[model samples]
Target: MAKVSISLDAELVVEVMVLAGVGSPQDAIEAVVRDYIARGHRTEARTELKDEALRELDAKPQEPQG
Candidate 1:
């Protein structure tokens, strides 16, 4: 594992620790980081799909309505 140093609000850190029922700051930090990374991946995938749909739309010609 890698060691990273990040500064967070003291109150926010305490809240996360209490909610997670974790004794150490590291455990709370790890849980938050993991959730953030997972959500990021999901967002990226959605963005890519949206872009692809836009491209397909742009490639299609509009049809005239009677």
Candidate 2:
């Protein structure tokens, strides 16, 4: 995998380390990025499902009632 450098606030780094249970800020960031990427797939799947539902609704004919 490729590597990149990022600058984060000191407090935010500390928070990430604690939340991720990682030794360093870099490890915490890596864990967060991996989790985000994995969760993003689920998010896209949900969006597609919602769009399909909207499309189905649009395609349905309206009923006339008195």
Candidate 3:
């Protein structure tokens, strides 16, 4: 694993700790980043599913009712 050193706002770090429910800065940051990536993946999956559904709908044959 690569180690990085950067400055962040103190309040932001504290908030991350609270929101992420983690003890240390590293854990908090990692949790938040993982959550963000997971959410993005879920959003992409949903979009793909919707597009697939639309394509399937378009491909289906239509029936005429009497």
Please, what is the whole-model Cα lDDT of each candidate in the order they appear? 0.93, 0.92, 0.92
Encode model 2's per-residue lDDT on 1-44: one tens digit a residue: 78788788999989999998998888898899889998999999
lDDT of 2: 0.92
What are the clash counts of all predictions, listed in order?
A: 0, 0, 0
Give the better candidate number (2 or 3) by TM-score.
3
Model 2, stretches more than 4 Å misplaced? 63-66
Q: At residue 9, give the lDDT of candidate 1.
A: 96
Which whole-number lDDT from 0 to 100 does residue 45 have in model 2? Answer: 97
Task: Give the runs in model 1 whose Cα sits over 4 Å from its true position.
Answer: 6-9, 63-66
Model 2 residue 23 distance off true place after TM-score fit, in angstroms = 1.3
lDDT of 1 by residue, 1-66 (tens): 778798999899999999888889889988988899999999999999999999999999999889
Q: Which model, 1 or 3, shows the larger TM-score?
A: 3
Model 2 clashing residue pairs (backbone): none
